[model samples]
Target chain A: MIRVLEQIGRVFLRLFEETGLWFTMLWRTMAWSVRPPYGVGEWFRQMVRLGVDSIPVVFLTAMFTGMVLALQTFIGFQRVHAESFVGSVVALAMLRELSPVLVGLMVTGRVGSSMAAEIGTMRVTEQIDALEALATDPIQYLFVPRVIAGIVMLPFLVVLGDALGIGGGYLVAVRLMHANPVQYEINTYQFLDMNDVWSGLIKASAFGLILTLTGCVRGYYTTGGAEGVGRSTTAAVVNASLIILLSDFFLTKLLF
Target chain B: MTVATNMEPQSDPNAEPMISLQHIYKSFEGKEVLRDLSIDIARGESVVIVGGSGTGKSVTLKHIIGLLRPDSGHVMIEGRDITEMRPVELNRFRQHFGMAFQEGALFDSMSVFENIAFPLRRHTKMTEEAIAARVEECLEQVHLHGVDGKRPSELSGGMRRRVGFARAISLKPEILLFDEPTTGLDPVISDVVADLIVEMDRTLNTTTVTITHDMKVAFKIADRVAMLFQGHIVEDGTPAEFQRSENPIVQQFIEGRAEGPLTDGTNE
Candidate 1:
């Protein structure tokens, strides 16, 4: 019993330690974000790297997800003679939850992992130390641009993802499933209040903060060597994915 | 426990040392790496610290640059204690230093020219034309030329170290710190690097401190050589005095012998 208790205590200690580290990183990034020499050039470059480059994959994922969701809901509603409601269901789900969560996960996998690996390699190779020795703040030079890009870009990506996803549902519903085109279009927008779209965008912004902060924090504290970079990359993807999922629930509760 | 008598450098008594480390004690994960270590380097002097691997040489350099803080000590630069400064103040304080790492640590994402140009772009308001000329001048100072368009990955180890040197000197810093500058170079290249250091020290006339275990490199570039053993300075003097010292550990290290107080069980 004593051994089990000790193990449990260790787990909680690690959790608290990690939480504090992430919060500290977030605080510093914010503090540096407002400082002079805004590094606007790097910020735009990262926006293209983290946001624009992610468009194709995010669109693909959202389209497929919406089609599958439409098909499943259509078939189930048909059993109850409520197949007409399929458009509403698909549109509501995509706008309120699916688009933000899926895009967050996708960006986490694509950009977050790369950020961790890049910074982690710099850490091990002593490049970061060289930066400090040159009288440059690693936080201002490195973290601010990436974090700002993430926070500003994830919502825009989700907005595009939402459009593609709904369009994909339309493709399946009208072309393949033979749902009434006019009725389906009307139902899609009828049930989606302005709140539904706002809530998802807000969640996307939160997810943006979470994924980028996690990547930077993991990369900054990385030790060991090449193996440590690999570990940070894997942890960045896994932890960002897990946090997006966990935060989605809380965000949904608060937003709704 | 054998401390050399010539632990102090032969400098003028009235002038302040350019850099001073006082009672520095540092450890990692409870393993003590530096214990009550202290050293004073005069302005415009070139000092080399010689120590074996894992002897906290890098840690000592890091402390001087504010990269790592000592557990209980003071790192003073130009009579100002840096240990109490905040992060922003420390960064401003560090503008006076130019540190070159063992592996060059050049940013792989940039070309050689950009690597050398980074500090000037960040710290100064030099226009593009002026920055380009300065980069060329710095590269020339390190005896490197026309490799600006290439990446660091495309350069040899010796060339990479030179590029790192060019970058370090770009800002014309007041103090220079070199961490094992010749660790992974051939003897010929190491000698060339040593020559470069001597030339830079003479031409720039800046205070410089280098940490290396290579006695040859130490003798070639250092005005004074200090030997670190068991987390403290065991011997410090001119190269001639250091070679003729009676300390068994310093003798063993200088001679590269395998059997002595350093390798024997007695020191532990």
Candidate 2:
């Protein structure tokens, strides 16, 4: 029992240490993101990679999620003969929760993992050190642009994903479920407002910060070798995902 | 203490060294790597640090550039202790240095011309025309001709290292560091790198600090040699003095024999 308690204590201690290091990276990224010799070109490049390149995957995931939700709602509501509520349910679920959360997870998998791997490879290969030796701030030159890109692009991606999702629901409901197209559009519009979409965009912005910061922290501290790069990349994906889920709860409570 | 004190006088013969590592000690994950290493390099001198594969040869060079801060010691460069510097200050301070890595840590994402042009693009306010001329000159000096737009992945190993050297010296720094510069190169290429080192020292008058296990590279480039054993410098002298020394460890290392003091723990 004593040994088990000691192991738990060590785990908590490690968590605190890791949190402190992560916060330090955030502070540095914030400080350098505003400093002189700004990385305008790098920021735009990351915007294209993190935001523009992710459109297809986020769109597909949102579309399928909306279709499934619509079908599921119609099936359940049919028992009470309340099929008219399906459109409202689909729109409310999408704008308030599904689009932000699903798109966040997708971006975490795609951009976050890739960020960790690229930076980790650079670390192990001494490219990071070489950058430092050449008098360039690695945090400014490498990290700030990525974090900024994620923060700015996630909302835009969420907005696009939300549109695709609602459209998918419309297509499924009117064509397949034989619902009144006018009634479906009216219900979705009346039940969903701009506030729901705004809350989701806010959540997406937070998730963007989480994914990029976790990736950069993991990659920056990576040591050992190729094996170490592999470890950090895995850790980045896992930690970013867990943090996004945990924060989603609090963000939902606060936003609602 | 003395190195920090002699900061003012520019032309004095008794001025402090250009680089000094005093009483450095470092460890990684409870494994002691360096335990009280110290060395000094005067202006215009080429110093080579030689040791076995893992005796902290590269670690010492890293400390000099502030890449890895010593657990406890003074890494003095240009009469200032670098351990006290902020990251921003350190980046500015590193402008005085040019380091060539073992495997030529060129940016694999970029082409050779862009890789060599990185420092100028990042740290300097030079025009595109000036940057181009400078990069072209550096490529010619490193003897890599007409391979400008090719990616780092497209080059051979020797060609890649030469490009790395070209990149390192893009700004024509005051100090040059070579971390196992000839580790995987063929003998002819190694000789070419060695000649470049000599030419840099003679013509550019840059103070050089190189770490290598290759005694031939050491003897060819070093005006003085420092032998690191375990974690400390056991011998410091001219290459000729090193050749005449009777220290069994130095003898084993220079002679490439595995039967002497250096091979003590191998069979134990």
Candidate 3:
């Protein structure tokens, strides 16, 4: 019993130290990120890639999700006289929950994983160190552009997701669920307030920053060889996904 | 060594030594690598430190260029202690030095032209046209004319080493460090790199520090040679002096002896 307890204590201590180092690095990276000598071209390029290029996939996901939600709600509301409220329900849910969560997940897989792998390769190849040797700060060259691109673009992508999802919900409710199109549109626009969109957008922005930062951090600290880089890439995806899920719950609670 | 010490000229009247390492000590984990290692490189002097693997040869180069910090010593560049430099000061100090890694650590994502132009784009205020001209001149210096659009992976080993040399001297840094410039190359390619080192040293008068296990390269380019053993410089002299050394470690190493002080011949 004593040995087990001692082992548990050691594990906890190790965890604490690891977490402390991670936070310290995160804070230092953030501090360095805001300072001058920004890479405008790289930031612009990443913004287009992360934001503009991702819009179509986000739109498709949101539209199908909204259609399904309206379908499900219609079946349940059929027995009661609550059919009129279906539009409101789907719109509110899509805007407040699904849009942010789905977009976050998609971007995590696409942009987050790529950032990790690219930076990990650079780290292993000594390109990052070479950048430092050339008097170009690696954080400014590498981290800030990705972080800025994520934060600036994710909110817009969330907005696109929210709009398309609500549109799909409208199409399903009015056409398939046998509701009046005008009335359904009115209900969705009226019931889904600005606060719903704003909260989801805020959460998306935070999620974007979190995922990119964690991915880059993991890749930057990777060691060993090819195996090391592979392990780091895997760890980056897993940890970014976990942080997104955990932070989503907290942000949802805090905002609501 | 005493004779070589007497031949050591006074410090340059117009400028200080390009780089100096004083009592630099480094250790990884519990193993000490460099112990009380001191090297003074005058302006335009080409110094080479020769040793077997794990004798802190590369670590010494890294210390001089401010890549790795020494545990209990100072790395002085142009009479300034770079170990205590702030981030900005260190970046400025870095601009004065260039390195060609053993494996030719060129940026894989960049084309040859871009890799050579990288430091100029990052550190200098030169215009794009001038940068291009400089890049061309540097490539020509390494005899790598054309092939600027090719990536590092597309290049052969000798080509990559020449590209590494081109990139190192692109900005014409005052001090250049080459970590095993001739490792794993054919005799002809090795001679090419050694000649470039000598030619660059002569043309640009750049103070050069080369770390190598290749005795031929050391004898060719080095004005002074230092042999590292057991974490300190056990021998320091000219190439001729090094060839005629009486120290068993130096003699054993030069003779490629697996016995004597190097191995103690005990593993059998």
Candidate 4:
């Protein structure tokens, strides 16, 4: 019993320690972002890599998710003779929840993992230390560009995702389910206020910060070697995904 | 156990040492790595630290550059204690030093030219043409030629180490540090590297400190040699003085004997 209690206490202490480190990294990243030699070229390059290059995967994931949501809603609404509401349901879900969440998850898997792997390799190879020896702050040289890219570009990805998702729902409902085309179009816009769109864009920005910060933190402190890089990459994806989901609940609660 | 001797060299009394580690103590996970370790290196001196694996030779080098802070104690550079400096201040302080790693540690995303040009581009306001000229000069200093467009991954180990040298000297820093510069190289290449270090110290006139286990490399490049044993400086002197020292551990290490106090505990 005493050993189990000690183990539990150790786990909590480790958790608190890790949380403190994460926040400290976030603070340092923000502090460095405002300093001189902003490296706009590197920031823009990361935006292209993390956001633009992820379009294809985000596109497919959003499209299929919207289609499935429409299909499921249509079948359920049919029993109640409320099949016309399926379009509204799909649009509302896609804009206010699914688009941001799915885009965040997809980018976390793609860009976040790569960020962890790249920086972790640098850590193990002493390239990061080399930066310091050259009078460069590794945080300013590395984390700022990536964190800024994640923050500014995630909302844009979600906007594209939102459009594709609604379009996919339209195709499923009007062409396949044989719903009234004109009503489906009208209903999709009817229930979605500007508030719904704003809420999701805001959630997207928060998730952007979370994912990038997690990746940078995990990579910056990585130890061991190739195995450590792999571990950090995996941890970055898992941590970002879990935090995105967990934060979504709080964000929805706060926004709505 | 044979007692180790502290064989510090005679120096001018009035002149201060350029770099000093004053009684530093460091530990990792409750295991002490450096204990009351102290050493003073004068300006324009080429000092080589020799030790067994994991004796904190690299740790000492890191302390000199303000990369690793001691658990307690001061690292003094030019009479100023760097352990009291803030991160930004320390970064500014680091501009005075250039360090080359064992494996080069070149940015893999960059070409050789870009890697050498990195510090020049960051720290100086020199025009691109001047930066190009300086990069060429640095590469020339290391006797490397016309591999600018190639990636670090494409270069041989010796070539990569040379490029690292070029990059380190790009800024012409006041101090130059080499962490096992000749490690994992062929004997001929190691000899070339040792000669380059000697040449760079002469031409650049920079205070130099190197960490290595190779006694030949140490002797060839060092104006003075210091041996670390059990987290302390067990021996320090000129190369000749070091060779003539009566310390048993120093004799055992210099002879490269497998049977000695160094391996006594592990075998049993």
Model 1: runs farther than 4 Å from truth? B1-13, B266-268
How far off is residue A215 in model 1, in Å? 0.8
TM-score of 3: 0.91
- 10 residues in a row with least lDDT, candidate 1 chain B: B1-10
* Predicted candidate 4, C-alpha RMSD: 2.4
Q: Per-model C-alpha lDDT, please?
A: 0.91, 0.89, 0.84, 0.92
Distance from true location, Cα of A188 in model 4, Å: 0.5
Supply the global lDDT for candidate 1: 0.91
Q: After superposition, how far is residue A200 of candidate 2 from its true place, in Å?
A: 0.6
Give one digit per residue, the lDDT tens place, for model 3 in B1-268.
1111212334546666667677778899989998888767777788889988888998888888777899998888878999999876797678887788887888887899999998888777899999999999999988887789999999998899889888988878888889898899999989988998999889887888899999999999999998988787887889998999999988888888888888874472
Q: Per-candidate TM vs. native?
A: 0.97, 0.96, 0.91, 0.98
lDDT by residue for model 3 (A51-134), tens: 898987898899999999999998898889788888889888987888888898888888888788888888887777777777
Candidate 3 lDDT score at position B162: 87
Consecutive 10-residue window with the lowest summed lDDT within model 4 chain B: B1-10
**How would you encode candidate 2's per-residue C-alpha lDDT over B21-137 as one tens digit per residue?**
878899989988898877777888899999999899988999999999989988889789999999889889999999999899999889999999999988889999999999999
User: Of the candidates numbered 3 and 4, which has the greater DockQ value?
Assistant: 4
lDDT of 2 by residue, A1-256 (tens): 9999999999999999998988899999999988878869889999999999999999899999999988889889999999999989988899889999899999999999889989999999999999999998889988999999999999999998888888999988999998899999998888777889899999999999999989988998898898998899899999999999999999999999
List of clashing residue pairs for candidate 4: none
- Report the Cα RMSD per candidate: 2.2, 3.0, 3.2, 2.4
Where is model 2 more than 4 Å wrong at Cα? B1-13
